[model samples]
Target: MAKLRPNLTDVDPVWNRIRKEAQDAMRNEPLIAGLVHSSLLHHATLERAMGYRISMKLASAEMSEQLLREICDEAFDSEPMLGQAVRADLAAIFERDPACHRLLQPVLYFKGFQAIESYRVGHWLWQQGRKDLAYFFQMRISEAFGVDIHPAAKIGRGIMIDHAHSIVIGETAVVGDNVSMLHSVTLGGTGKDDDDRHPKIADGVLIGAGAKVLGNIRVGHCSRVAAGSVVLSDVPPCKTVAGVPAKIVGEAGCDQPSLSMDQLLRATGE
Candidate 1:
């Protein structure tokens, strides 16, 4: 458990600096504020990872490392795609959101940034066989942040948890790139098998507020899940779904946010 914690090497002062920088950056970015809230909950995810790791000691260290490598990559910032997606998200936010300004504000204040980043570190430690410590940090981050992500979940790049309050992503959930989810969205199970029970969100899908997607269903690319809807079955690409058990409601082609000149000019500050 102790092994899972950050090494805290005297030679490396970067972690503290990075944390401070992230905080300072998010102090003002409106888009990042939601992410910051989510990040505060990262500790829970880490704890989950640690618990999982404790069960992996029967295997050899090399085998344990191999089994957890993919999860670690998916969790930590060591994977370049994560950073790229984050940057792209910031760019898109800047292009469309008038209330945001300065990269620093978002980096520091966004719960998403902090939680995701903490997951990365916790994931690394979990992989190294220090499950208890990893879980400790993960739960701490989760308690601090409103966001809750399972360490075992496979999340892709360009994943956007927009306005992510009350959002719960479960274990065994697979989220693809360019997927956007609004507030109060839940990717959950249906009391089925513990393995691979959550839904899979494909690329370029937009999920509206308060939507619940359950079971092992797949939400296809370019699909739109309307607000307050509950998805149960698999949705095809380019479709829009709504209702209790979400059904195809309309076509979802190029449905994106747009920013006007006045809106863009309203909040451009340092």
Candidate 2:
């Protein structure tokens, strides 16, 4: 069990709320009381809790839970930005996903959230030149969560990946801040290229389910990629694109399409 850090509540309202919710959860369902206690209440900070969760979810016969926990803890301790990203991601999920009712929900049950946090640890390893360990994290994350994100992929904070099944992000893919995407979305390369071959998704973009933005193209900020669209070119800011080889359909419909979680396509008159 992890020890609580002192003065955490004074500066971290998110952790405070999560702890409060964990206590409430224990009261609401006594069966999971032990789980809630170990996963949340035992920890001093959000980062420690996150490290435990990540290790628990990704641990296997090949890797011990204790070792994984140590790696995750080291990552969080070495990089303050990882903890910041965790808070941003939790907020993004709570704010964007209707199914997410509490900050604790994503931490305890959401595979998407778990997978992304695991990816963050893998990414930290990648940055530290621990490529083999990073690859191990990627493999375990994919097997455990069905979400395949290369450790080399650069994904920004405040990202919400709903469902998260069959999601693929290749090496060199750069996803900007506050981006939202549903299941089966792929940010991949067109074909045989070794350098910088994946798509670049800008900030506040909403990518609907089954959308594939391939090649080294840019999907500009605050844009919308309608479900099942196959985007092969660059998209301008605040535009909606849909179809096999997606073309501009209309405005993104809101300033922050990702946050709005809107997927409808309105006609010209409307």
Give the best candidate by TM-score.
2
Single out the weakest 10-residue window by summed lDDT for candidate 1: 259-268
Global fold similarity of model 2 (TM-score): 0.97
* Residue 211 in model 1: lDDT: 90
- List, residue by residue over 57-105, the lDDT tens digit for candidate 1: 2124333544543454344434444334445554544444445564434
The local lDDT score (0 to 100) that residue 10 gets in candidate 1 is: 37
Q: Mind giving the per-residue lDDT tens digits that candidate 2 earns over 117-188? A: 999999999999999999999999999999999999999999999999999999999999999999999999
lDDT of 1: 0.58
On lDDT, the candidate that comes out on top is 2
Q: Which runs of model 1 end up more than 4 angstroms from their true locations?
A: 1-82, 95-98, 124-130, 255-270
